[model samples]
Target: MLTDLPIRKIIHIDMDAFYASVEQMDNPDLKGKPIAVGGGGKRGVISAASYEARKFGVKSAMSGNLAAKLCPDLIFVKTNFDRYIEISKKIRKIFFDYTDLVEPLSLDEAYLDVTKNKKGNPSASKIAEEIRARILNEIGLTASAGISINKFIAKVASDYNKPNGQKTVNPEEVIAFLEQLDIRKFYGVGKVTAEKMYQKGIFTGLDLKQKSIDYLDKHFGKSGHYYYHVVRGIHNSEVKPNRIRKSLAAERTFSENLSSEVFMLEKLEQIANEVSRRLNKSKVAGKTVTLKIKYSDFTLQTRSKTLPYFISDRNILLETAKDLLFQETLNNSVRLLGISISNLNIELSKKSEQKSVSVQLKFEF
Candidate 1:
């Protein structure tokens, strides 16, 4: 461990095939079956798949037709966001029992800072074990976890033993653990980026560490610096709680591209309504509105404006998106559009406001 950097006790929790597992739990007929949670028709995308389906390489974001071809008996269940959100809230309540420094990555995953928790637990490993057990006992769902000195390592370690398991990277093991890890397993290194790293002779974390910071910066740009530090187990991103929502957003991907402003307006209004609804659900309003455009060629662009006061009305959101939409001409036909509101009015609690992270390297997380 680097003496200069602070040691934190972070845990990343990920639900095992969350959507598919929920389907199995709710409908016993789907139990122990190869299930894909999403549409099965043409133009359908698999949102999630069960471990049973995973044996045949069926996975999330896979084309429905291809998934069927791979697993002939794959059962498709419709996506149920309402049920998923309801279950997610229950899981979050469980987290608060130990600590309030819970940062939810999504409905199925979160990062919790257990360095100083309500339970006064010293062992993050035990905390993780108990949390997983409680989820299985109380909610009837299995969750996996990783405990380590920081969020990046915790996130990576969570996948070591999956489907209701946990791994802890002790303070002494952090460096060696990272060195042996495959570059492909690194959180931010996707297929394309991994290929780029491979071309630079960076197949593992050890290989990544061998390169000079300058060399990595030349090849990977801004992310080069990120790769340089994280391989040394030095990611310092904190587990910001739910009270700190930076923005509220809603987006939709179109089956057909919108070729003109006239066609785009109809879809933009719908997205604005969703953004407005989410803001109200959180009981917050924003002063800035941003219009995100994804062109048919897959390029992304955004136009934003800050308002004089916060607003959450759908009409106000629609009008703001409209103004930004007309601010610039289309570079290409848009295949996706989104509306986001930022600079929120989510006042932090006094207790949360007073909280701060402090580190002690001797603690066994």
Candidate 2:
């Protein structure tokens, strides 16, 4: 089916050891050193480990103690969520400059559909090269990119060249590439499935292609249809953007209950700033700004204001939030301060005005 339709241009971009790379970028001494971004204490899980650490058998999702055993000199650092979020925003902005259709798998990986790009460049490989260069120059980090005719191939291509590299898979070469690929390399075919496939003599794409759709369906259920087409270099998935805000929330549990307006305003500023950042990152502007307060007596109250236009500006958001906080009477010591922005506007385009005019006979009047 992919061969029957016009070829599309898709790209997958993944940062190299995202959190560990960020740590290295911030500290020059950590370069070429085995580093992990996570707590080194007991009961800590590794968030990310540098390539150097990987050579010693350290990996993300592994327990920190296990990583330490693998790499005796592994350096573990505390996670800085704010800093990581900031860098993620910058990387996402670069993707948007090239194409509006970007699907972020996480903070470090994304799928971009460049079939109709903002740059109007027909060559997807060239666009990927430019994007990779821009990210390295601006973010002080390296990323790997894959360019292909569809999402499945593009995702596979990105991993082909890891740690600051790029790879392209043209439509014509897709079949040859798939034929030689090991079954384990296929998306959704993990270790368990790979073992099962191996037992069935389905070790490669060619082996998978030989199997009937019904046979695969009997084994894999709905995903069998996906395997049936992908082995033949066919994939129809589209890049989807983050169009809605799943939750709009901001909260601060203070160390001490405070009745002072000054202290409460300061806390509200921080909450509003966080909400604004999240709204902007998701490309959503909110019409309602909600203020929440929890008193020392365990009583909770909330007030919300809906504005004429959606807003994401920090100053306007904070100012409105502070005003709402002051409007409510402080009956007890406040133990918490919160703000949330909701009712997202996904579309960026302005609405066009519709006008109607009628002219009467002035002479008759």
Candidate 3:
């Protein structure tokens, strides 16, 4: 249990509407206006929405048409991933300066272990405040931070005060803070899980705490144990720095559902090229290729193939994607097509080194 273990100071930092905020910051005309950063077409889904647009019920993943209807004056901007990546690198540099124990969740969010930081600062709250301030001054954008004894509480606390704010949860207050929290607000408790908890009469942290671990496991499967520990403030996941990249992918939803084999082939070629670009940008290659297909009716299908050698060339990726697409029969008109490469070579050298070290140790013994 977390109470029995030495507490580690953790902080979860999340940017404020990252992509949309970057658009607003670069274009003064977009500032203080309802804007969405995404494709603006019949089939386009919003990637991010500014707080102003959110006021009128706009949200990420909503259809562009629906978002436009919600806020008639809403403006749409195409995604600029290069700019977002540049800014993300800057933010991550700030995190590394403070602690090497940083785990990035996305381009806009990360968990940091600051139990012992480079600055030798004792207060996590002060560190969070300084980090947030640095982002605003250096990057011209706002961020929110949550400071607590562990990652779970820190992640949740970050949302309590958003858009240039910070919150701290002390060790002594962890239990009380958790008990009063709504089940829906708990990390890993999505809408479906919350409904299941509601059906079982578990509405809050205190209610979840009442269930025996056996009962929870019996009802909720493996996640049951997770809930049991989390309700008691027992999350102990570490913040791992320089985590390996598992895969690189590119996907797109069509403006119109496509059924023609020729059209599907063309789209696959484009998506494979995108995957190749991302792989090259990351300086990685992969041995496994997966193709994802989503039908207009929402049914999904996936096909994958593992190659004998790692590859990153655009032609090879496209050809492999083509083979996978043709191998599967068309079940329905496709609405979305995606290509991804996994089993990346990024960590292969490290694995080889570890194996060599183990062999050396065994020989010495």
Candidate with maximal lDDT: 1
lDDT tens digits by residue: candidate 2, 200-312: 99999999999999999999889899999898876766666853444577787776789888878888888888988887777778888888888889799888898999899
For model 3, the stretches where C-alpha displacement exceeds 4 angstroms are 346-365
Give a tens-digit lDDT track for model 3, residues 1-365. Answer: 44453358899999999999999999999999999999497898999999999999999989899999999999999999999999999999999999999999999999999989999998889999899999999999999999987789999899988878988878777788899999998989999989999999999899999999999999989999899987787776777787788999999899899997679888888888889898999899999999999999989999999999999999999999888888958998999999999999875424322111111111100
lDDT of 1 by residue, 217-277 (tens): 9998999899999999877676778547899998887777888999988899899988988
Clashing pairs in 3: none
- CA lDDT, every prediction? 0.90, 0.84, 0.88
Model 2 CA RMSD to the hidden true structure, in angstroms: 13.8
lDDT of 1 at 174: 83
Q: What is the lDDT of residue 360 in candidate 2?
A: 20
Candidate with the larger lDDT of 1 and 2: 1
| Backbone steric clashes in candidate 3, count | 0
